[model samples]
Target: MRSSVDIETIFATMAVGLVAVASILMTSAPLGAQDGSRSRPVSLGADDRAAALESVQFALAELGDGASYVWHRGHGKLSGVVQPTQSFVDGKGRVCRHVVVLLSAGEKSRKTEAIACRLENGVWRFDS
Candidate 1:
């Protein structure tokens, strides 16, 4: 037989737990689905472009409207359309690559575009 105070404590604790779980799920679930895969640009038609653009779109969503990106069409080592990656600029303005995917020779003919951004003053802004 729990008292009223005891019941209130339980409900409060449960509500906090639910909020924590929901926050984690909302943040982590969309990016990491074990089944569905996103596409990357490669040598192909419109479908291939759409597939390739999925990653770009995901990255751009909720991003600052002023963010900028450039077209990088060249040789890469990425195996899949999307690969784990990071980008940063050194003090001298040189860009750094953390992870990259090498593409396949078969997909070399695919045409694509990319948008990249930089963090400025704790907010993301477009880069040229």
Candidate 2:
């Protein structure tokens, strides 16, 4: 079994990684940019967004790097995949993970990359 220290270390690493992802999301241009033209951000209905967030939270909480979780709802109108690409410790010592979320509805799809970190209450949330 892993010791408490080991677990803490792992969480710290994840936090750092998540912080980096948040930074990137804040500063970088939107994803899917091509030819210097910005693309419209993917839009999801409230319910679909919530559903996708659940999958993202689950993936960041339970899956390791490169692992993916698929989520679908709304009679298949809403579907997507969540994957964590990396993990690290944030400056505030929170555990974080860099995640990729793809949300699709019918023929339209939006891809988002963000960082997720555990709050003090032990719940995971996307950092900004």
Predicted model with the maximum lDDT: 2
What local lDDT score does residue 60 receive in model 1, on the 0 to 100 scale? Answer: 42
lDDT of 2: 0.58
**Which candidate's TM-score is highest?**
2
Which regions of candidate 2 fall more than 4 Å away from where they truly are?
1-46
By summed lDDT, the worst window of 10 consecutive residues in model 1 runs over 16-25
Q: Model 1 clash tally?
A: 15
TM-score for every candidate vs. truth? 0.25, 0.62
- Residue-level lDDT of model 2, residues 30-59, one tens digit each, is 223323545553333445545655666678
Give candidate 1 regions above 4 Å deviation.
Answer: 1-43, 59-79, 87-101, 105-115, 118-126
Model 1 local distance difference test score: 0.30
Instruction: Give one digit per residue, the lDDT tens place, for model 1 in 91-113.
Output: 65644222221223222322222
Error of 1 at 74 (Å): 23
Q: What range of 10 consecutive residues in model 2 has the weakest lDDT sum?
A: 1-10
What are the Cα lDDT values of the candidates?
Answer: 0.30, 0.58
lDDT of 1 at 97: 27
